[model samples]
Target: MKLSINQLRALEAVVRTGSFSAAAKELGISQPSVSNHLLALEKHYCAQLIHRNGRLAEPTELCSEVLSRIRSVLAMTREVEQILEGRKQLQTGTIRLGYSTYQFALPVISKFMEQYPDVNIEARAMASHDLMPLLQDGNFDVAFISAKSPPPEVNAFEMRIEQMVAVVGKEHPLAQFEMLQWKQLADLPLIQREKSSETRRVFEANAIKAGISLKTVLALGSWGSIVTSVQSGMGVGIAMAGEVTELDNLVAIPIDDNELTVSHFLICLPEMQHIASIQAIFDIASQ
Candidate 1:
């Protein structure tokens, strides 16, 4: 008997989402249909591929071993479909894009949209660390991530190099400095992004190496919130140089550390890079 694509997709979605109903929603199918597909797959192989524990669905050892290959298969299937679609001159399609920051991606997206107006984009904003995993899970066709090094599995195009800077209210004393050291921030109450933020991760790691202990008085979820808190004098905030706008009350001072730099990259699974729409994004980004 031939293995069914729907069955494989059902298993993959269930394991990725961790629940039958969630997988059903992701696949845009009914819950019973998802269950039936998984049941059919398991019966055909004579193996229990998933272990249902309460609401969570955990893949069995056998399933775990095959999941990566299944993902590759699915990715390749999409690639083939895109290849066939490309013969149509890339008139219409959707690009699932995940971005950590809009500062860089917005411009490229703007250019791509101007050229391919018929193409629809589904953009999701997430933290840098969170974006990569979702991109790898095939949730996003492409992503903009901030990191010191690109992951080995994807093809990355350098978008921009950004430096970490200290943002302060104009009344703050640190605002007068053109450049500040890690130790200069040690005594200040800091406003930062969540723990999962790559900016925070980079800043904290550099501070530790500089032997400085810093205090974070607030952990905000978004750059806008951090900027607002800093402008209101809640605390000093860390941000990328580009993230700081020309707001009257806020000042962005350079951090005098070489390692305080982050490279923003536009990345996609290597297999999907040749797709016409995906290739167009890369081209736009390079310019």
Candidate 2:
């Protein structure tokens, strides 16, 4: 018969406890069962693993030489079991997340963290243009991004459709208007997000279609920077609806064109959707 884990465990327990009856008690098996396992182990390996004298037992020299390795193997087995159990229970794991904007991603992230406080999260905010490639490269387990359509390689769940809007400082001349047309901003100094921004992309595309050449005075990398610049009265800023805070001394004016909108999606590689942490976050976002 081939060597088995039970045989190894019985041998180790007998050697450790110094008696067959004690080893049987520790292993939750009868003394005869422990003897049979040890006998089978010795017969298979052609080496006596233990020496017995009355109620006492001792490891033979050869068994002693390999005892440390056997203990290591059993320790590793227990660790593997614990890891699998933790994952199955959603008690431990890390999720790498990429986001274009926190406005949409943070709410879901907050809920996920609240529900699974033991799970670790690594969240990176980046330009919408950079999110897809990094997510595809396996740098992210999931991503929240703004796009006209989901890429073919990933699975996407539509979160919401956000409209592009003009953000002007409270004191700016155009802030008083309830809504504005794209052509109205053609002559104004527009402060925009970086060229990689999906908001900027949609706005420029719509402007081009409307036959308006915008005079963009500054291109900032972050939403805060655009808001700060606008607050300082640098120029009018462009942003997605619901992004500008009410207390920021800014007014978000809806643009007249419906085409100036983007769909936000929560996306992941199709195979990764089954991972517990990723699936948990997806469920939270879906709800």
Candidate 3:
């Protein structure tokens, strides 16, 4: 009831070796100390933990039960030691992060890695709605997403508040307009992200609210494709704030409707934040 873990190990060793002298030899302790631990455990529990028959010691039923628990405790101790060793491994190690292509998640990630070469990084492309669960399930250490809340299971950093904006090639006739109306964009071919993506979701909401319907939307596989299609004068694309807006060939006009704004989330499971590399990545992503 009130015994040390070492005392429990000593008791188990004596039972396993079936002799105080043998257990002491196995444990590299004096036979007397082994006897003392058995005595101390027996005294604390007020029960016979081990018994002698002929020259051999046998574990009692109580010792069997107690040793079962002690084995688990010792295994847990080993796990703790291994975890500490892994923390050292993370000092200059990789942190796997996930992100979607809608936001400028790449530029921020590339910049962070450039500034910290020792911090290796692995980035996976994923949808924002799915990134949270993968992070919480330990598939990724962290991920950037477009969400206001990261659910109860994940901790989130509100990285950037982005507005879904209509973008077009700089030379396109509509690109020069400072403001756009729903009717103006309705007839233009919309180069959109896959239906599951957040950018597409926001655009859908905006379209529904504005009572603007498009008979034909080019549903591209990736955000980049949408941008490419827009840049090549094939269609107009809507996206969150991206560095693509800085390109001389592209122009981004913010959508002034409630359906257009989405907050960017940098989400992580609570455990991964303890790793030095992950913490550093978090700090860098914020900047």
Candidate number of the best lDDT: 1
lDDT of 1 by residue, 1-287 (tens): 67988888999999999999999999999999999999988888899999999999999999988886787677667656755786564565688999888878899999999998878899998898898888877789899998888888899998889999998888898878999977788878999888888889999999999999989999887777887788788889888898877753589999889889988999998867867778989999999
lDDT of 3 by residue, 109-165 (tens): 877778766566788886777676566434576788775445666667787777677
Candidate 3 deviant stretches above 4 angstroms: 1-89, 111-116
lDDT score of residue 240 within candidate 1:
89
Q: List residue ranges in candidate 2 displaced over 4 A.
A: 1-88
Looking at model 1, report the run of 10 residues with the lowest lDDT sum. 82-91
lDDT of 3: 0.71
lDDT score, candidate 3, position 235: 80
1-287: candidate 2 lDDT, tens digit per residue: 87678887888788777899998999999999999998888887888888888889998999888875665465444445546978555576677899988889999999999998877899999888888877754467799988888888788999998888899877888989998987798879999988887888888998999999999999988888988999999999998886777767789999899788988999987756656677888999999
Q: Candidate 1 vs candidate 3: which has greater lDDT?
A: 1
TM-score of each: 0.86, 0.70, 0.63
Q: After superposition, how far is residue 5 of candidate 3 from its true place, in Å?
A: 18
Q: Against the true structure, what is every candidate's RMSD?
A: 2.7, 16.1, 13.4
